[model samples]
Target: RFDMAGVGDSELVEGGLLYVERTRADVVASMDALSERVDSRRFLLMGLCTGAYNAFRAALIDDRVVGCILLDGYSYPSIRSQIEHYRKRVFQLKRWVDFTKRKLGIDTPSGSAVQGDLVVFENEVVSKERFAGELQSLIDRNVRLLLVYTGLGPLSFTYRRQLHDAFPKIALDDVATVHFYPAADHTFTLPGHRQRLLDDLDTWLADEFESETAARG
Candidate 1:
């Protein structure tokens, strides 16, 4: 996928929340251009981390987006998730081994951060009700969602079905597709983890849109 303005190597230009307006405009422009040359108008948006949040907001604003693939995106604080996260951390021998290595300066963990001052990012303050509302709106528009979380994500998303637990009132557990890879970090640092992510993505893409020749914008 192409980078939104102010992202990647592109020159930074600030806009509204999460740069939604600029991103929306850029995406729509690309969609129009793509549609002129392609047979289908429907679109799918797949993004990671901040890109995922941007894609999600863009989908809400644009009806052409038929589906979204969100990786290591939004999640909220919940007791169950906290328990699960710490429980695994405390019980897993590998976790302690890795921690000891880091503590001993034998292993330095790689970060998934963009070294720049142009764009500022903080945790999004999205309440459960608001998030549920937005999700329902997308659902009403027939936008299929594939939500995936990695080990570096929020504690609340430790389990595959925790999305529902985070928002029990929503029917997302039954409706939305969710996956979790506890071994994978936010950026899939390991080769095996990256391959697993690609494999899962391929299967999801095939299962959802194999019959339709749609543009993935």
Candidate 2:
């Protein structure tokens, strides 16, 4: 995958901003460039963080995108998600110790509480209703969707079931595959974590693409 404009080796415009629209445009441009060189029409968009968001959005609009692998992508927490997050934190001894220290004026509160309000992304947030609709559209088109979560932060995805729980109405099991690697950090800095990430990707790609090929034949 190529880097977005103003990032990595790509030339950055003086006042360029990587907003949603611009990011989508860049993805389209990249696809167009690829088309000129490759004979294949099918494409699978894969990315992490904002890149993942872009890939999802791109796949929704572009019929050529047969699949997408989203890593730490859009996560909208539900009321239950918020409750579950704090419920887990409540059991942590460090949390109690910190609370007691603050109560006794021995230490100041560091604002590290696991809360939903803290789960904000820099770009505009898509409504759950709209996301659900988009997700359905992709499923109807038979796009292979893979969502992978890492141990970046619990605020966005506190648990393995958070995605399914947030969109209870949507039948995600029928449309998407999800994996959670809570022990691995966001970037997968450690060698073992990186290997785990790669292994997961290899398996997903083989299974998804092989199934698609068999279906076409």
Candidate 3:
């Protein structure tokens, strides 16, 4: 639950590529400090959106990161996901209402999904081959993962199992734990959505590492 620099309780800083780099450094530094202070050898990193990317990159460089819980992380474009994503929302009345509001400028999201103050970061996905190689390398090292996708704009993460469909070359069927929640928004704003996510987290952590943690404790 540590807040890295440029985020809550830390010195505010400009967002963008620089912010991404800063967080990567922060994650490594935090792990290093934790290793020295608590005599901890292994760690699990969790991040949301861009932070997830940072944690993932850090895991590649540091073997100490044994697991990650990535929420709304890198979502590659998939025709299948796109069709299903649009199909689910196109018929929904709420979608029409929200579209109308945006068209009329009644409730516009900040930055319009492009470069702007709030949207300093774009939903840029790494190349499929490159990403597959990187991810497979991590898997080869036995890095455990929990990937989650919600009803963030289709551009962010449209559906659950998007990761599997996006990268069939990688044997993620058994390697990763994935969950999707189409009813929840990007940030899990609804109480029900948040509760569901928390419950899932509890279950995942317990199943994956509770025994090891208890033995250490």
Candidate 4:
């Protein structure tokens, strides 16, 4: 429930948004504080949006993190995703209207598929190759990863199989689980959506803990 520096109750710092190194340091500091107070050795990192990205980054470096729950973390559209996006758009009424207008030289599309506000970090981009490598490293360390995606715009993840497509070299079955909720918004604003998310989390956590216990014995 802790907020990163410059967010929520924490004091703002200079150059906070430009670099992720500070965020990662904050996560480690929080984990250290928790360890001093609790007897538990296992830790689970769960976050949404930017929080998700930080959690994932922390998990990669910290072996103490047993599991991670990421909600719409970091995703980039692969070539296949791009093709699928435009393919679906081709059938939509609005797309055709826009296309016709462009053909008639009446109107033109303004920008790329990716939105400007969606860009959170500056000068730090995680390539798909590096991401896959990090994912594999986490898997090798026996870290459990749960990726959850919502129906928010700029659909980087429209299908369950996109993860596999993005990291074709990695064997995800042994370590990763993915869930998609195409009807819900990014924040799960609706009561039903929230309930569904809770239920799913509960089920997954129970299963994950059981497996961890079995592995220990």
Candidate 5:
């Protein structure tokens, strides 16, 4: 539940892209703070959505970071895909706005993905400010932008397969990789699947802890 300097709990500056800093010292300092709080020589990291990317970056640097678990990791798409997706969204929003205007004689702004179900695309939804912040952090830290958009993308299955291959190598004695509840969206809350997701998460965590204990003996 710990956050880095420019994010949630730490909240450094109040301007554009707080996480976009070149200070490796700052990154490690944040890690040090979290590590001290937990009173542990080694720690497990878990991230959801953009948090996954940040966790990945931190794990790469700190050996004390013994393991990581990521859910619904988003791979950055090419500029072309970003532009296309943006244009498509704009067109769809315009169409919706026009229809609403015709029907109600007024236009409504879109709601944010954070506020409600993103698929529903409510008119009252506000812009997701987190995206710019998160993406900027990823870019600043040079976190490997996955092949393309994180969830169900062109390489979704491939990325999972690669991770599966890496599992044996990564889930070593003190070090481990645990992916809980496959396809559980970002928060591990998807319709008609919470039970299955919970089961998988429980199994993965149990196995990880068990394996870690056995390694100690």
Candidate 6:
């Protein structure tokens, strides 16, 4: 699976994961380019974190995507809400840095312990950036997709409700299952959890593929 632009190894020239809108646009571009070469009708899209949001959005726009698997991500909300949340953490970090400089009379980094909390909160806001109007759009297209969100993170409750309301065919229990994870972190990179999650995914995917194959036969 290829990583989209401005992510992982594909960092932007400006540096840092600051511009989320640009990243979403890049994902869209990549999807459009990829669709040209393959049969859109058969392609299956899967992603983790922000990539999950991208895959869902791509499926909504391009009819070629037959299925999607999303892991540990938020649903669509206004970019404004995301931006405001992001700014709060950034300002906090900046305050800590400035306070240290003023008190110490020199520029020095704050204690690691304090920095850690800031990082967690920062991640919360960062996840929201990729959550554009994609989930709602996906339901509108009647896309067959599985969205996995953790019970442990800072997800928008409103958005989750919106997802359930949008897809009446998808019951609340199914939606609860879709956002499965032992922990509420972004990726659930914890030990053993990854494998367990993957195993569940493998079973679900096998079922889907088998059903498709049977229909074709």
Measured against the true structure, the TM-scores of the candidates, in listed sequence, are 0.74, 0.82, 0.76, 0.84, 0.46, 0.53
Where in model 4 is the C-alpha error above 4 Å? 13-18, 76-80, 107-109, 112-123, 211-217
Candidate 4 has an lDDT of 0.79
RMSD (Å) per prediction = 7.0, 3.3, 5.4, 3.2, 10.2, 8.6
For model 6, the superposed segments whose C-alpha errors exceed 4 Å read: 9-25, 28-40, 75-137, 154-177
What tens-digit string does per-residue lDDT give for candidate 6 at 94-209?
66776778688985555774455333322235242243344445545555666676645545422334445434444433223364553546667686777777787887777657
Candidate 2, run of 10 with poorest lDDT: 108-117
Give lDDT tens digits, candidate 4, residues 1-217: 9988888899866764555788888888888998889855678999987788899999988889989998888776766877977787778797677778878988565746323424443236778888888888999998888888886633456777678777777898788788888887878889998898899888888877887678888
Question: Candidate 2's residue-wise lDDT over 1-217, tens digit each?
Answer: 6888789988755455557767888888888888889856889999887778899989988899988988888777778768976787879897688678878888654575434347554477788898889988998898988888875643357667788988888888876888887777766778998888789889888887887688888
Error of 5 at 102 (Å): 24
Instruction: Sort the predicted structures by TM-score, highest score first.
Output: 4, 2, 3, 1, 6, 5
Per-residue alpha-carbon lDDT of candidate 1 for residues 101-187, written as tens digits (9 for 90 to 100): 877888544533321211223345567788889999988887888998886654346677777777777778444789899877778
Superposition error at 154 for model 6 (Å): 4.4
Best by TM-score: 4
- Residue 131 alpha-carbon offset, candidate 3, angstroms: 1.6
Q: For each predicted model, how many residue pairs clash, with residues at least 3 apart or on different chains? A: 0, 0, 0, 0, 9, 4
- Where model 1 places Cα greater than 4 Å from the true spot, the runs are 9-18, 85-124, 154-156, 213-217
Cand. 5 TM to true fold: 0.46
For candidate 5, write residues 1-217 as lDDT tens digits.
Answer: 6555556676564435434232234545666877689756666566655565556556566666555565555332344545655566677765566667858967455445222323421112223344345334433443322211134322232233343243332222233232333344544346546565556656666765677668877
Pick by TM-score: 4 or 5, better one = 4
Ranking by lDDT: 2, 4, 3, 1, 6, 5
Model 3 scores worst on lDDT over the 10 consecutive residues at 113-122
The alpha-carbon deviation from the true structure for residue 38 of candidate 6, after best TM-score superposition, in angstroms, is 6.0
lDDT of each: 0.75, 0.80, 0.78, 0.79, 0.47, 0.58
Total backbone clashes of candidate 5, pairs 3 or more residues apart or in separate chains: 9
Please, what's the RMSD in Å of model 4? Answer: 3.2
